[model samples]
Target: MGPRNMAQGSSQKPEFFVNPEFITTKTRAIADRKRENTPVPRFTALVPRGHTVPVLNKNTLVESPDGSYRDGPSTHGTDRFERRRADIVAAAIPVLNDQGFKGMRLTAVAELIGLRATGVTYYFPRKEELAVACIESGFAVLDGLVAEAEREPDAGARITQLIALFTARDAAVRQGEAVPLASFSAIRSLEGEHRDRAVEGYKAMFRRVRALLESPELAAMDQTDRTIRAIILLEQLFWAASWLCDFDIEDYPRLAARMADIVLNGVAPGAIADPIPSLTAPARPLASRDESKESFLKAATRQINEHGYRGASVDRISASLNLTKGAFYHHNEAKDDLVAACFRRSFTIMRETQIEARALAAPEACRLAATVEALIRFQLGPEGPLLRTSVLSSMPVEHKTEILGHSYRISRQFASMVVDAITDGSARAVDPMVAGAMVHAAINIAADARPLAMAQAPDIVARFVRPIFAGFLAA
Candidate 1:
């Protein structure tokens, strides 16, 4: 089936897979620790130590020279405390983007706001609580955009408005006009109440976009296809916050409009483009045990990509490769170690393909186009698996931090290529960082775009890259 058809039609939208739930007894134990005032083990990546706890209830209302209060919470006292928390969250936004949920540190956030870590921690007792606040603040901004988009009388205009809103809001956040919030991508790293809130925000956004995509004008499109397209569009928009700072501040509206156009019509210079090619069959088998190990990795990647890390089991992955659990254990000591290996493999493949593209003797645009095509083909090929970093969240805290460092390095490499392209005049002048992020986002979302497989890789790459770069309409 095509990527479009991969979306299973149902009255309910599918829930994204989360990390495996803790054992009932273990969960209870943790709750018991909380009640007993004993320190429970927390993910080091999610919560760093060494912050001084704030003294309770210092409600002084001294006035500062800048007309701000010296001491007070936002609602009760003088609103100074609330403003301080807001400032810390803002500083933490870029850190969250750079370090991700698992890697972000309260010390880093405190440094950003020129406050001691203890001062910041006084307001937020736990890192999870702070992260939750940031994530929710971001959603509030996004929800406002969606609400405004809903005001459009024509359903056709809704999508474009949303795209523009996302782009502009991202710009506003970067400029410090608005508070910083974690992108929806951070949702994977959250658990418990934080995860629940983030999930609700995502579901609401999905429903609105899905409804807009199902308009009469899009009647020719299947409902499932529409759902998939909406997801693709949202991914592109949500990732905007990462790169918007790299571009000229004034270009947001135009860039947003271009993005909307590309999402809706696609970047075919003239006539409508043909569909991209799809994967046909699995890779050929080998006899050696070494080959078996490789096979297990590939199958494991695919299984994880299809069903989240929690859902994909050793039995299922091994079964797909016609191997026993013994064979699986032969290749790896444990699932956590195996998954970390899988992530390394995925990053290595992508980095290698990108390096090869750069070595090609061609114009920068052509080189970029080649790299994009190669990556997509690899992602859809028998050996190709989508780069789902959600795997990082399921691993040990130490592993999560290590993998995140590697991912950031890869992203910088991508940004470097974009900078080279813009400087060489092979691509339009935009924020290279933003452009690079958009490319990564596209590749990530395309994994589920099974429909693209029906077309050739070059054509598919062109269709996908065109919307982001050349845009759909000609000047």
Candidate 2:
């Protein structure tokens, strides 16, 4: 089916109908008010008055005295239909972020807004449609931030401004003034035209961010350098939301400044020569002794990385390995078991690499650099592409918590290394915790760099890992 048709309900097709009175008296007035006061752009596009598409003004749904959102008089009188739809979108954002598209349930979203499954289906017939809407809203929010950042005089200033704006918006979300941003990692689980639209939107946002590095001062960098840096910056921003909860909301601005400092100037000391170590040895094999189970996990990890946890069905995993369903069950008890195993395998590989890198006779900074380079190389290698951390969203709460505990321990290990680097005078006096988290984020995101040819591992490490150690603007 086509993109538009895929979004329609089986019994009734969605119509682009909105009441004119609501547009003039409510939506336009709010838009005008927001335009006059807010320097940053609003979340979604507001179609002109009398347009066929309904006005989706998230600002109009105000919180009542009881803390629940109550529709305005115009919404009750004229645009109840559209208002209800907007409410569903707002409620679904957090659910989608937590559960991913595969785990997101229409009934769960319905419960949040006190609507039946049928009620939500009336607005968004298919869950994919609702998911697409959530993803689009996320893109709109990011586009607004990028637009605000573009006003800065240079790339460094723009990057700093971007982080500041993100933290401010995040603070607003915490204060209940805005909706939570949707997670884009699960976009891979979407199929057909829905996936196409989401991917296009993401690429558009990526292009805008990549353009930030196009200033005359940064003109010496090639497109490949810019692309790697842009992805690092964007991934770090996305990853920030996951860990920002550790600090009080009041510390957001301070955290943003520190994060920007790390991104712009990096963690290396000014007098340090060659932040990256010359590690010519090949990465040690990350596979387990059980070749049969290892084969299953390798295929499963690749599938999960590409199609998400839910989309990576037992059938798909079996077929990828030229094995039958019986074979899958013979080795694994259930799909969740497989997913948990993948997470364990990934964690083991990371910890082993860290241990090996630390054992090197090299300086602390070189050990950290070697660790990151080895991980990136493994990501592009044959045994490669570790399970993405995004899969944690699709997992059950208990499983997710356990996995997160493992992840935290690994991150703490990295933090210790950074502390050592600082003490040894090889790294700058950056927050070891923040720097470690950033390093963890970068390594986790390296699995997404599968398109980079294995032959270019050295250049990829230079362009990607070097930037993380030394600043993004480093020659």
Top candidate on TM-score is 2
Model 1 weakest lDDT span, ten residues long: 47-56
Q: Evaluated with lDDT, which candidate comes out highest?
A: 2
User: lDDT for every model?
Assistant: 0.55, 0.72
Model 2 vs. true fold: TM: 0.82
lDDT by residue for model 1 over 1-475, one digit each (tens)?
A: 0001112222231111111121111121111121121222222221112111111111222223332222232335445565455555556666665566667788877765556789878977787767666665554445445554655545557777777656654554444333344555566556787677656756665776676655555566555455545666777775665455556877776677656655554332221122222222222222242665666677887777655565478897888888899988887898877777777777766676677667766556556566666666666655666557644544567678878777767777767886776677665555555556666776767665553444344445444455444442211
* Clashing residue pairs for model 2: none
Q: Residue 419 in model 1: shift from native, Å?
A: 18
Give a tens-digit lDDT track for model 2, residues 185-301.
778899998898788778877888899888999878888888888888988898887788898887787888889999988877342356555443334555545878888989999
Runs off by more than 4 Å, candidate 2: 1-79, 269-288, 452-458
lDDT of 2 at 171: 61
